[model samples]
Target: MTNSLPTESELQEAWIELQEIHETYLLPYEVKIPHVDQYYETARSIWLAVLFYYKEEQVHKDVISDVCQRDKPGLARDQQVRHLKREGWHLSGKGGYHSLDPFQPSPEWVTERNRRSGRLGAADFTQLKKFYGNACATCGAKEGRPDPRYGQDIVALQHGHMDPAKPANDKDNIIPQCQFCNRAYRSDYVFDDKGRVYAVADVGPVRRASRQVQKKIYEWLMSVFG
Candidate 1:
């Protein structure tokens, strides 16, 4: 059977309802995707689910599921949603994303999912800052100029743990810099304290350059010049 797509008006109205729910709820929710593309797709699906569910109240749940099942991933990847009797993201029998417990905090749901994925805990900021130094590792911006609005540096520095949940707190693992730089640059491969490597985000320069190569080059240069 052919799948049905929502009309423009329906999509817009549903999105508005979803927006209201998001504003009211905004609590952290952890998402899981073992692969890179799957992760992005999951995020998109969540967004679309929110946009449509608010308007039709999930009347189109069957159609949506059918289309997804017929597509590349088929029914296997699709999650079997259940009404969140105790938390948010409850799937009513109607079968669509619904925000029943909008105000209820889903800390248990978030923590449990992240723990399963091995992505728990925030970065150890104190230790992380020492290794990378208090400057934008990329742009080398230090002591940024004051901002008129916040009465602080326009570039407020933060300890950017390469991985937010799985922080290394290592000199190489953490970078001290403003939010802009951290968001832009820190979303790449970085070395943890144990010399292990990890990818932060979906940015270019996927892998980090070898420290061994750098050390050898520096040592050779020192021997030649000094």
Candidate 2:
């Protein structure tokens, strides 16, 4: 519900500790942090961005690029960010670049401790479904109708986050999605209310394509659908 940013004091402490780790080159949980440069570069900037913007906002991809992009030229900024989760950075996508601050208790943790404590109520969920015509907002799979992709007799819909990365459990941030969508698609790409793939963080999901070809595809999409 609330966004958190690292304070100046926290950043200062992190910087001091960063130097210590760099000198010692110790790994936490047997995970290597790569080579740390006193002057922050691509990897360092990414870690810093995720930490600073944790728990609410997405890490700014453009700012990360501006700071340092010494990695692959073909890699998109969001793509660079997605890999952090593998490195034990708690991040989420399929909406935008979102992160969970390790220091903070996430909505998941809270809900585990107390069910529906900060989630949408049944009344709000019903209203949301009605607004979207009791159908999957992304695929138009009407509730009780046969599944579109699969041959199920009934397509049950559930409360799905508009941006799964953020903790907006309100109706505004929710939509109806079938179980197939909620789990299968997950948050690989951010979808519009209409269920269109509006934003993609990584090209891997789209498969490997040259940068030039990808640009053309983007232009074509914007021209035709933007």
Candidate 3:
């Protein structure tokens, strides 16, 4: 039999279930992300668990480990971050600070047309850039300001709509963004040139303690296990 990919509905259902499980069981601790026990294992298992959770399929740890090894090799801690950045995986920080960038998987920056496609004109985008000072809201590095070697690559961030476009912008709808976030996720009308769309409420970061590196680890862990 040929293997079949999951339908979008299946994926959404799985993601919802994963969040439900996390909320009911693990959200209380406010310490560690549930399901991950050891540091190395935690680092390794997080991504596969999220893949399975999002794909709504049973997953094997060996396969997960193999993928991590294949993609990241000896560098274990950052594999999940790379995965999210490359694949637009739907995930979140299990603890504080997702990464030094605070925006992982980068695709989360694209805002979906949700019913508000009516309001997402060039003006909205311009206002957004102005509000964030034309720099990455998460990183604060403006265009032309990133390392010279990185050039545009350094400041090529995008805009993330605070609320899904369906509800439309009501003043609190704008936010600065970067390439490290997931784009409009699971939403129709997300254009190829525009980038993928993600839910703003689901991905936004708040004030917290952990330093940059520690937060990066925690954020990478969320990309994996969540």
List RMSD in Å for every model shown: 15.7, 19.8, 24.3
In candidate 3, what are the lDDT values of residues 1-226, reduced to their tens digit? 1123333344445445554554564343221233533222444244534364435433433444444454346754334443443333334443321321212223332332212342333466765565456765544556555535455466565554444543445434445555543242312222222233332233233223357856886799799999
* Candidate 3, residue 167: lDDT: 46
Q: What is the C-alpha lDDT profile of model 2 across 106-192, one tens digit per residue?
A: 334343433422224335777667666788877788898888579766888987767766675755567788777877766666766
Q: Deviation in angstroms for 57 in model 2?
A: 54
Query: For model 2, how many clashes?
Result: 2
Q: What are the runs in model 3 whose C-alpha is more than 4 Å off?
A: 1-123, 147-152, 164-171, 181-226
Which 10 successive residues of model 3 have the least lDDT summed?
Answer: 96-105
Best by TM-score: 2
Off by over 4 Å in 2: 1-123, 201-226
Which scores greater on TM-score, model 1 or model 2?
A: 2
Give the lDDT ranking, best first: 2, 1, 3
- Model 1 C-alpha lDDT per residue in residues 135-201, reported as the tens digit of each score: 4544445536553433665666676565645555643445556666556664564534322345444
The predicted structure with the larger lDDT, 1 or 3, is: 1
Task: State candidate 2's TM-score.
Answer: 0.36
